[model samples]
Each structure stands twice: as structure tokens, then as C-alpha cells.
Target: MIVTRFAPSPNGPLHLGHAYAAVVAHDLAYERGGAFRLRIEDIDGARSRPEFVEEFFQDLEWLGLSWDGEAAFQSHRLARYAGAGERLKAMGLLYPCRCTRAEIAAAATEIGPDGPIYPGTCRHRAVAPEGAAWRLDVTAAMNRTGPLEWLDEGAGPQAATPQIFGDVVLLRKDLPASYHLAATLDDAADGITLVTRGMDLFRSSHVHRLLQALLDLPVPVWHHHGLLVEPDGRKLAKRRGSPSLADRRRAGEGGLAIADALRAQRFPAGISLSQALNGTP
Candidate 1:
């Protein structure tokens, strides 16, 4: 059976962009007569609030999204993430780097949409100083492609020859698990067969796939959908607080109304809320 998951961080309220992602995952699972999973990516514990986490469930339910099995929270699975990091370390795929944001900025050469493009400075460094951050030694990996390859459902497979983020951070100075680590672990643990999310995360797939290869985790199929841009042609952010499911609930709108509104806003043909959830065609 095909399995997919909707993993969202509880750093803020769920906006239209989130709804689009959740709906896509839910609908894909239903269409394949498979399972949908939900995961709370609360790795950034300092910024993830309990209120935001609670609101996430409320919003997903209000928007008619459901999942199989228990909900997984990243904060509670630090050990698992740490284990993966250790495995990567054992493979000589990682090393400690004591570079702060300012320090990295100073060394940064190519900047792109995803912030600083990592320059491989710590690749062959024998030892790192104390209080250093952990980084993936991309070059040490057996298949370190300067550019990576990934498969997307809607757009098919594609490859980028240049590195997206150079020697990206896998672990912080305080040893907190970063999104890349936790997300990769959760995807493998959940046995997810497919991944569907916004195109904004399209680049992250290369890193994730590389990790999968390093750690021998299954690389799920991905579909990077377009975002629900606002009238001004701007994508929604957590701070914007668009007409979320919670807001609609307060306005006395039911699930169907919310679904209709979403569909009216350029949803693909023949896709209904029911189809999105249960695939009852």
C-alpha cells in the first residue's frame, strides 16, 4: 500500500499554503487507496509553541484531513535522529565545524534563494575545535554529486548540477536536530512511499535524497505542487494568518464550504473534498 505524510512545523498557524499541501497529501493517499500520516516537526523546540501545535491539529481536522496511525512529534524522537546522525558520522559523512552564522557568512561565496550556498571548507578537516557545529561532509559521501538528482510526480525526474547548500548543517552547536535530519528520519520511519509538498521545498529534496542514500533509507517519490499565491502574487507566510480553517470554524462554515472555497480557488478539475480525503469517487 502507498503511504504518504503531511509533516508541518508548529512554528505558526496553518495558512492557505499549508492547506494546499495537506489536501494534496490526503488526496493522493485516498486516490491510491493508501494511508495518510501526520507528523509534527517540532525540532525547533525554542520556537515551537504548544498553542501552535494544538492549532495545527484543529486546522487539519477542520479542513477535513485525516491520517492513519498515531501522530509523530519530532521533539520526542531526538534519540532516533541522533542515531541517524551517528550513523552518518560513522560513515565519515559528517564532521564537527565550529562556524557561527556570522562566520559562515564571511566564508560564503555563492548566495541564492535558499540563503548562503555552502562552500566546502570543512570537508577534509581532521579535527574540529570545541563548541563546533556538526555538518555533513558531502564530499566524503560515496556519491557526492556536485549537483543532485530527484524524482517528482507532476514534473517527473530532474537533476541540478550545482550544490544547493554546501555542507549543510545536520546538527547545531547545542546538538539540537535540524529539520533535514528529523525530516529524513521521520520519512523513513513512517515507511512513506510518496511525498507531496510545495515547490518551495523542491531543493531540499536533493539533500534529503542524499541523506537517504548515505543512511540507506528509502527515497520516496515526490510531487512539488505550486503554492497558493495571494492576489498580489505573493506566497503566504506563517505570520500572515490567512483565512485558515480555524477562522472558518469561528465563522460557522463547515468542512464542505471550506473545501468548496479551496476548490473555487484553482483546484484541479474533478477533485473534491471527499475525493481529497477518502477518494470516494
Candidate 2:
């Protein structure tokens, strides 16, 4: 059966961008007679809030996005991430890295898609496992997997280039697993067939495809859709104080009405889905 997921972190309120993403994933599965799953990415214990999680469910319910089966939470899947990380370690692809962000920024020279890439200084260090950040050796893994590729439903066939993100983190000191590790593992666990997400994460798909190969997991087709943006051409983000779905709800907006408006490509004043968007995924 085809499956898709709308995974969100419960660190803040769901904004218009989030609503668009949820609608896309939910509609893709529901319209195709597939399954739509909702997963909570709450690995960051320090930042994740219980109230936010409650609000997330409320917002999704208000948006008319019904998910299949029970919801999955990253906190409940730490052992799975740990097991995968250990397997990568056994393969000699996972290594301990104690480099702080500042230290890495100082050492890094080239800028990749996600800020300055790690300088790989800790790759040779004999760092301990406990309370240490673990990184994946993308180059070493690529050498093992040879040339790899995956399909993007929107962009068609493409080669997987994991080199853009050098030595990506698998596990952080404060968390059992990083976003990369948790997401890759849980998708396989839930049997998600189509990874529906925004195009901003297109580069992330390259790293994820490589992780799938190195971990011996099933690869899924990705649909990297366009992003919703504000009138200023800026992407809606929680950190930027974008209006939350809850805020609109408090103002007495109807859920289905908003969903209909979005379907028509209409957004709140001065906001719109990126003009680069084509047909629905």
C-alpha cells in the first residue's frame, strides 16, 4: 500500500506553511486510496513542549487532516535510531565527533547548502562514544555504495550526491538521535512509500538516499513540493513569527473553508505559495 507522512516538531504552533504541507501529504494519500501518517518529531527534549504537541493535534484536527493508525513520536523510537547508528558504526561509517559548532565553523572553509560544512577534523580523533556527537562518513559510505540514485516525483530521475552535507550528524550529545537518523529510520518503520515534503529539502533527499543505502533500508520515492511564502517572498517560519493556524482559529476561521481557499491557490493577504509551484503532488 502507498503511504505518506506529515511529520512535524512540537516546538511551536503550526503556521500556514505547515498547513500547506499537511494538506498536500494528507490529500496525496487520501485521494490515492493510500495511508496518511502523522509523526511527531520531538527528539529535542530541551525545546519540545507538551502543550505544543497538544496544539499540533488540535490544529491538524481543525484542518480536516485525518491520519491513519496511531501517531508516531520520535521520543518513542530512540532505540531504533540507536540500533541504526550502531549498525552504521559497525560498518565503519559512523564515528564520534566532538567538534562544537563554533569549532566547526572556524575550521570550515567552503559553504555548502546547509551553512558551512563540517571540516572533518574529528574524523581522526579518538573520541569516546558516551555523550559525544556521532557523524556519518558520507564519502566512505559512497565509496561502498558506488554511484547511487533516487527518483523525485516532480523533478524525475537524479543522482544521489551525499557529498554536499559532509559528515552529517547521526546522534547529538543531548539527544539519542539527530533529525537525519530518526527520520530515515521511522519512514522505513512506517513503510512510507512516498516521501512528500517541501522542495527546500531537496538537498536533504540526497543525504537521506545515501543513508538508506548505507543502512540497508528500503528506498522510497520523494515528492519535494514547492514552499508557501509570505508576501515579502520569505518562507513562513515559526521563528519569524508567522501567524499560526491557531491564531486564525481563535479569530473564528472555518477549517474546511481555509482548506478550500488553499486549494484555489488563495492565501491570506500578502502571502502565497511559491510561484514556482506546479500541480499538486
Candidate 3:
């Protein structure tokens, strides 16, 4: 059976982009007669809040999206994340780095989808200072990128290779689990056979796949939906006033209105990606 998930970080309110993602995943699972799981990615305890997480459920319900079983929270699964990280470390694919955020920013050049790309400043030099974060040895990870292709429902085929994404951090100085580590490990633990999220996260899938290879986990098919852009073309985020479901209901904009607004937006029908590959679109 195909299993997919909609994991949202509970640091902020759910927005239209989140609704689009949730609805898409829910629809796919419904069509395939599979399972859709909801996971609260609240690993960042400092910023994550119960109120925001509570809002997540309300928002999804308002948008008419439903999932099976009890929702999973990353914060409560540290032991599982640690075990996965330790497995990578045992394979000689992890190292500790004491570089500060400022130091990393000063050395970075390429800007990744997330932010300032890691300069691999600590890869060669092991200055083993106090307060260091653990990093996965991407050089070792590169060897594990086996031949795999994901038939993304929206993004079409995504081919994996070594040069796609460089060495990535599996854990941070202040945080025990980085996004890649927690997400990949949890994806396996949940038995997710499909991953549906935004295209912004699509690039990170390569690194996630590499981690799965190292840990001998099953790779899930992916579907990177188009982002919900604002009227000015900027991608919508929680920071902006993208009316949360609670706010909408308080303002008398019921679930039907929210659903209509989301459904009206032009989303991928899986034709464009195929067209682009065929040099048509």
C-alpha cells in the first residue's frame, strides 16, 4: 500500500501553500486507496508551540483534509532520530563542527534553496572546539547514491546523482536533529512510500535519498507541487498574513470559502513537467 505524509513545522500558522500541499497529498492517497499521515515537525522546541500545532489540525480540517491514525510529532521521537544519526556516524559519514553561524556565513558563496549554502569549512579542518554540531560526511554519502528515480506526480522524474547536493548537516549545534536527519529517519519509520510537498523542498530529496541508501531505507516516490505564490509573486509563508483557518473562521470566512480559494489557483496537472521534458512547454 502506498503511504504518504504531510509534515508541517508547528512554528507558525498553516497557510494556503500548506493547504495546497495537504489537499494534494490527501487527494493522491484517496485516489490510490492508500494512507495519508500527518506529522507535526516540531523538532525546534524553542519556536514550536502547542497553539500553532493545534491550529495546524484546525486548518487542515477547515480545508477538508483528513489523515489516518494518531499524528506523529518529531520532538517526541528524539531517540529514533539519534539512532539514525548514530548509524550514519558508525559508517564514518559524520563529523563534529564548531563553526558558528557568523563564521559559516562569512565563508558561504552559493545560496541553496534553504539559505546560505554550507561551505564545507569544517570538512577538512577539524578544529574540535567546544559547542560543535554534527555533520554528515557528504563525501562518504556520495558513494551511497545508488541509481534511483522518483516519478513525481507534479515535477515528473527526478534523477539522483552525486553532484546534485553537496555535504549536508544531519544535526545542528543547538538542535540534536537537523531537517534532513529528522525528516529522512521519520519518513522511514512511518513507512512512507510517497512524499508530496513543495518544489522548494524537491532539491533536498537527493540528500534524503542518499541518507536512505546509507541506512538501507526504502526510497519514496515524490511529488513537488507548485508553490502558492502571492499576488506580487512572492511565495506565501506563515510570516505573511496568509489568513490562517482560525483567523478566517473568526472573520466569517468558512471552510467552503477557504477550499474555493485554494481550488481556484492553477496547480500542476502533471502535464507541464512532462511537456518540459519533451521540449514542448
Candidate 4:
């Protein structure tokens, strides 16, 4: 059975990019007679809002995307993430770090897809794990599982190189778990067979593949689809005030209609989907 998910962080309204992702996953599963699950990635404790959670359901429904069973919220799965983190710690694959963003940026020489890769400032330090940020020892992890690779439906085979990002935080200091740990653990827990999301997250998959191996979890094929971009080739983001689906709902647009438009490669005025799913000019 092919199982896919449309996991969104409910910190803001669902924009067109989100709708494209949801519809793509939903249609792929629906056509294959598989399961399409919805996951609320509300691990960002400070930014996650109750109103947004309610709005998430409303927007997804409005866009005619139905998820299988109950939606999984990351906030409610802290213990599960902790258990996985502890297991990694016992395996000597994780350690605690106290470096803040400012400290990392100052020391960083190589910038990653997300930001500065940690320079291993705390890897040698004997910092107690409790209440401290935990980072995955990528060097040790890669040593255990040598020469890893994963399949991408669109791009074919990919070599997993997690060391490019150095040590990735698994357990956050403020939040219970970081995105890498929580997402990888939950994907296995949910029995997902296929992972589909924007190509913007393509690099993150490298780290996720390593985590899956280290945790002895199930592996899933991935499809890093092209991102929906503005006509000028800029990525659509909530922070830039992209028009949300809520506003479109108020204007009496149907979810299925928008989904159909997206499927047909048609988009709202002033924005369009990129041709190169891997990279755009």
C-alpha cells in the first residue's frame, strides 16, 4: 500500500503552495487506492496557534483534501520523539549542545539549505543532556551506516550526504524535538510508504535518510516535487504575505476547482509553477 502525507505547520493560513502540495499528495494516493494522511506539524511551540489548527482543517476541507484517520499533531507526540532521542543517545549517536543561533552564525564557514551548519562547538563538551538541545552525531551515524542512498520518484537515485549539514539538532532546548527527529520518527510510526513534499526540502531528506537508518526505522521512497513559484521565479511564502486559501474561500472559490487548476498547471495570476522541479532559473 502506498501511504503519503500532507504535513503542514499550522502557524499561518494555507497558501496556494500548500494547496498544491496537499492536492498532489491526495490525488496520488486517491488514484492509487492508497491512504493519504494529514499531519499537523505544530512542533514550533511558540508559533503554533489553536486558531490555526482549526483553520487548517477548514482550509484543507475547503480545498477538498480528506485525510485518513485522525490527524497526528507533533505537540502531542513529545514522548515518542524523546524515546527515539534517548535510544540514539544510548547508541552514542546523539549529544547535547548549548550553542545559540548567533554563536553558530559567527563560527559558521559553510551555509546550508536551512542555515549555518553547526561547527561542532559542543560535540566535545560534556554537557548534560537534560533540558539541553540534542544534536545527532552525523559522523558517527554515517560510520555505522556507510554509503547510504534513497530513491526519488522524480530525480531517480540520490546519495545521502548528511555531513554537509554537520550535526543536526534532534531535541531542541525549548521544544521537545526538532523537525528532523520529530518528522523522521513520526513518518516511520505512521507507516508511511512514500514521502512527498516540495523540492525546497530536498536537502533535508539527506539528513532524514540517515536518521531513519540510525533509528532502525522503515525506509520510504520520496518525491521532491517542484515548488510553486511566483511569475518572477520567487518562492511563495506566508511571510511575504502570499494570498491565503482563506481569503479565496471568502471570495467563493471552490477547493476542488483550485486543485484542478493546479493539476492542469494553471495558477492564480502573477504566480506559476516552476518547470524544473529540481532547480529553477
lDDT of 3 by residue, 98-147 (tens): 77768777888876555666778778654546777787767667756547
Model 2, residue 249: distance off in Å is 1.4
Residue 182 accuracy (lDDT) in model 1: 79
Clashes of each: 3, 0, 1, 0
| Prediction 2 global C-alpha lDDT | 0.85
Model 1 lowest lDDT segment of ten: 272-281
Provide the TM-score for each candidate, comma-separated.
Answer: 0.86, 0.94, 0.86, 0.94
- Please give, for residues 28-89, the per-residue lDDT of candidate 2 as tens digits: 88889999999999888778987888888888899888999999988898889889888888
List where candidate 2 sits over 4 angstroms from the true fold: 275-281
What are the per-residue Cα lDDT tens digits for candidate 4 across 1-281?
99999999978888999999988899888899999998999878779877888888998898778899999888888889889988998998888888789999999999876689889988876657566788888998999999899988888898999887889988888888888888898899888888988887787889999988888889999977778898778778899889999999989988889888988889878887764543311
- What stretches of model 4 exceed 4 Å from their correct place? 129-131, 275-281
**Deviating ranges (above 4 Å) for candidate 1:** 142-149, 160-162, 264-281
- How does each model score on lDDT? 0.73, 0.85, 0.74, 0.86
